[model samples]
Target chain A: MQQVQQQTTSDPILEIRGLTQNFGGLRAVSDFNVTLAGKQLTGLIGPNGAGKTTVFNLVSGFYQPSEGQILVDGVPTAGLKPHKVTALGVARTFQNIRLWNDMSVMDNIRVAQHYRLGYGFFHSAVRSKRYRQREEEIAREATELLEIFELKKYADEYPRNLPYGTQRKLEIARALSIHPKLLLLDEPAAGLNSSDIHELIRLIRWIHDRFDVTIWMIEHHMDVMMELCTHIKVIDFGQTIAEGTPDDIRNHPAVVTAYLGDDKI
Target chain B: MLRRYSVHLILATLGGLVVYLAYNEYLGLYYLSVLMFMGVNIILSSSLNLVNGYMGEFSCGHAGFMCVGAYVASVLGVWLFARDRVFGAPVLDPEYALYAFPVIILAGGIAAALAGLLVAFPSYKTRGDYLAIITIAANYIIISAIENMSAIGGSRGFMGMKGVINAMEDTIYLPWMPIWVFIFTIFSVWVIRRYVSSTFGKGVNAISQDEVAAEIMSVNTNKIKTITFMLSSGLAGIGGGLFAYILGYVNPGSFNILKSTEIMVMVYLGGMGSLSGSILAAILFTILLELLRPLQIIKWIVIPLVLIILMQFRPEGIMGNRELGQTFPRLKKFYRFK
Candidate 1:
């Protein structure tokens, strides 16, 4: 962990210390610890039921931890709601592509800026000068975002109407609209075919290079993990089994047992 | 800019025409009252649509907030502008009632909005059917609370809002109730439209579609839910205030579960999340109610049957989720709803 911290010069964006979460008697995640800094791409991987998604949920403030602390930019996010946590410069995508299906694609991007809309209900209802300027700004920026992501053609279309791969792309675009310092991608390649997976890899790499965001992604695809992640952490049954470079993780005995079981079996 | 406000211009002209006809006695009292009720229904349906359609919360107790508004506005109007049996002499001159009526109605709306917190607070942890039951209970609690207050006439009902209208009429010799109803109806719809179009307001839509995703995406689900419920209930309160003055009386029995169900029917009939559809449904539903008045008790049975048939044929309602402009593209040239 200290060696990982030494690799990056900037201060840590996400610092988790002894995080633990229990769903009744079942321990979903326990004693998880990681310190991510700068703009490095990190990956979390494990077999099914390895508490991978649970860790993402904990970091994103969706689930309160049983014990431990999470800090975003060194500000404690222990009791903050998800939106408040997001306001501290964190954004995430779901494993299941949880875009607002009924809303138009443009709205999906626009609504992510809800935390910084800069106006209140009265401003909106009365359409004050401030409201007009803010709304116009939001619209212009949302348009620009869609253009950059090459999704402007589907601006007026609903998310459910978009193709599955395009929907995933749109979800990532929506997440990026928040301008988060730390971006959490949970299973971005979950349902994509080979070509879309290739496209996703390129998109993720481009986004990491272009957006200046520190990305932490969870993926089952070993190639995606190996290709994109500078560092990989493996967990099984809520326990951290391996942590190192992708090459080290690919050959680590504990990781292999966690994924493929032991040779004796 | 002219095209942007063309819809407002047309609505204003229609409102002015109605006021002119009513003031001249060219429109009879029956028609005037029917029009006033239509306005009230418009306020009710569109406001309820904000919660039920836009926010996607099953709030079946909308009338409870309306009842709170009706009583508050009625009592305030009487206490300030007219002599009341419970409150004795008027605090202000009756002559001022004409200008102060809107303030009284808005006060009622504010009160109803505060009352909406009853449901809004519980909504953070509960949703769907569980929230529905809480809202239904809240409706009962509100009605029962008023029924137990003997100072306000309790179950026997409350009166004196008629005197406020009469005072306004004496000052200006105008159709005060109809004009006020029309103004408030338009006002509520405009407020809802502006709210739902703003980025801040789109949080309501985000919550309805997927709340977890909404919260994680930086949409403050709780704040948005609170605002939506309050706005929805506050508008309904305005409708209730107008209804009280229109009938010159208010009874707790009038704002019961049946009344709430009527508003819900209007919301679903117009289509969820469509402002134009809600307005259209409110107008059509009000007219249908009046037309079926000859059936008296049978009207209830007929209304539900119609709703059943509507659900069977088009469960998404007349507009589904699209606005009138989206459905009829030609309307886009005449008006921009956003």
Candidate 2:
């Protein structure tokens, strides 16, 4: 670490209060509230269909909560669209990798910087001096990101050609390229083998320490959650049941009943 | 720094040389007509390519916008330049007609772009098959609505555009229609090429691949769709204006669903998301239509069969969404028309 003062360090970057979501008649998430301090590494773990992903969708502005509010960096974002939330410095990766399959890996990373690019369509078409300078910067940034993920060698290849683990890594690299203040990883370790899970845990830890951002990940694997996340929030039946440090969450009664059994926890 | 404009300089010079040759009568009338139609097809296919190919929207009503453009451009062209049929001699002097031609075409483009917004707004709520149906219905609605308007000739169609061309010729002794068509075609292709190679264009590809992810990535999917549709429809309008000039008449029947399908075939055959492919497909398709003219009704059957074979063998189309610059690295030095 360079002993740099991160922008997200002092204040709570995300504050959710009474956030509730309903799909048709069924409540998918109800009265969900949590607060993440800047630079906190948090985990959201639940059993299958525990509405873990729903919370991610709500915070990222994919769904308007049937009720309640979400504030990011002190600004309310209840009815904002996903792109607007992203512009507010919240970036997320889907449970299933959603990389642009036809684009080259390098282009995938560059696409996330779509808003930050100051030039308009006319400048790009004419390839003006500002366009050239900005484009060079985008390329350099994308290359640097790829280098961090060990994907520099595969920059020209399409995402579909990458192996499973590498594809997952590429998605993370893409989300990071947005320079988000809050990073949400929805089941980041889903479908990975044990060795790959170990690699991912290491990567997530490195990201938490290296990047000047807060992280909240949804994981089904308790081992990964316990090892990587300093704070943990547990949800079941579309409601938050327990939240504390990983050790306290491991010993919580409601969490044990909802997800991890007494024996497993 | 100025070396980047060499490709544009070369293209401009080539266009001028062709116009010069046409003026000198070096090319026969038949060849001149063929070249003009090629230019028109290039505009149609390339503009449609923006929506159908790169944007990955199933827009079956492209000709609806074209119809709007054609009527708007033709009616204005005749109203200003050919007043003999309506009231008396031309209200606007023939001397000004040549200068006013591009403005008239641009007006047509603006009208068509407005019409495009009508369709684009519905796209925010619907997508894929539902949006396709909306566009198809839009095509029918435009044609039927125009056919019902007897003031502009109704189903019988509208004429008098030829008089505007004649007015221009009477003012200046030069082949103006071909020159203007060639220039507009090049301009349309140039603008679209510039658009697709830009960051905005890449947002289009991202939407096509995965829309939700693109939205989450801060790519305003709705804004991009609206802009792309408007741009595509506007260029189609310009092509339609050129088309009305070439035919010297505008008929509601000329821009039916079949016309839209024809453009769609060119788009798919050329390869989705490739500007060079659009140009190549437009040329080859125009030639194919001419070659098949002898077969008449059988040509329709044969054309669909050819498309079927193409889809079966090369489903991604001729260029497979890769631009010419990507296919041939050596061409990269010539221009970055990626």
Candidate 3:
């Protein structure tokens, strides 16, 4: 078994030290630790119900960790709410694609910037000059982001009407609109066809290089993880089983046993 | 920019025409009262729609906030501008009532907004039917609190607001209540439109659609919920203030569960999340209520039956969350809401 050691990065974007989570008496995640830095792309892989999402949920502040510390850019996120955590430059997408289905695509992108709206109820109610200027800037930025993702044509359409692949791309684009320092994507290729999967792989790689943001993804698809992730971490029953470069993880006996089970049986 | 504001200009002209008709006595007292009630209903439904439709919270105690507004505004107006048995002489000159009418209504709204915290705080943990139960209980609590206050006439009701209205008319020979109602109705709708169209306010929609996504995506769900409940209840308070002045009295029994249910019916009839839909539904519902006045007690039964049939055929309501412009695209050229 690989030892639980932190990555030696001088400037880490996300640092989790001995993070643990419990649902009643059941241990969902136990003593999880990881340090992601720079613009590195990492993969987290495990079987269903293996606490992969619980890790993302803990990092995103959806659930407070039972123990340990999470530092985003040197700030502890112990009691900060999810939106406050997002304000500190962390953004994420759901495994099931949780876009605001009723809102139009343009609004979906615009609303994600709610953290830095820089205005309030009175400004909006009175339509102050600052409110008007900020709104214009937000609209312009949203349009540009949509155009970059080639989603400008569907700007006025509701998200529910979009095809499955387009919806996934829109969700990723929405997360990036917040200008996150770290983007956590939970299975971007889960529901996409083979062609869409290829497009998504290219899209994610381009986003990593273009946006200068660290990416941490969770996926069950082996080919996508092998092709995209430079480093891989495998967990089973909420315990870290192996951690290394993707090639090393591929050859690790612990990971093989965790995924395929005992051959002697 | 000019094209964007053209709609406001057109509405202003329409408002001026109504005031002119009222001044010339072209519309009688009966018609004028109907028009004023329309304005009041418009404020009530649109405000409730902010919470129920846009924010997707089932708030059944809207009249509780309205009751708070009505009592606060009535007592303040009587104490400040009129002679009453409860409070000897007027604090300010009766003539100031004309100038301070808007202030009185706004004061009512602010008081109601503070009362809205009763529900907003609980909403942090509970939602859906649980929140609905809290709101319903809050409605009872507010009504019971006012009903037990013997100083304000309690169950018997309170009056002397007519003196305040008379003081205002004595200052100017205009139909002051109609004018104020029209102005505040338009103001409330304008504020709501501006709020919902802005990115900050779209957080309400985000919360309604998927609160988890909203919270994780940087929308402060709790703060948004608080602001929405306050704004919604505050506007309902304004509506209640107007209703009290129009009728020249305040009573706890008037702002009861039945009244709250009426406002909800108007919201559902209009379609949730559409300001234009709320306004249209309010106007139609008001006229329907007035027309069916002859039915008296039977009207309640008939109205619910109509709503039931409406639900069976068009469950999403008349506009189905689309604005007037979206329902009829030709209206877009004249003015775009966003």
| Model 2 misplaced stretches (Cα beyond 4 Å) | A1-9, A126-129, A260-265, B1-6, B333-338
* Residue B141, model 1: Cα distance from true site in angstroms: 0.4
By DockQ thresholds, what CAPRI class is model 1? high
Per-residue lDDT over A50-156 for candidate 3, one digit per residue giving the tens place of the 0 to 100 score = 99999999999999999989998777899999999999999999999999999999999999999999999999988899999999999999999999999999999
For residues B177-256, what per-residue lDDT tens digits would candidate 2 score against the true structure?
Answer: 88899889988998897777776578999999999999999898888899889989989999999999888988989999
Give a tens-digit lDDT track for model 3, residues B256-324.
999999999999999999888899999999999999999999999999998999899998888889999
Off by more than 4 A, model 1: A1-9
Q: How well does candidate 1 score on lDDT at residue A32?
A: 94
TM-score of 3: 0.97
User: Could you give the fnat of all candidates in order?
Assistant: 0.95, 0.70, 0.93
What clash count does candidate 3 reach?
0
Q: Return the clash pairs for model 1, or none.
A: none
Ranking by DockQ: 1, 3, 2
Select the stronger candidate by DockQ from 1 and 2: 1
Cα lDDT listed for each candidate: 0.93, 0.89, 0.93
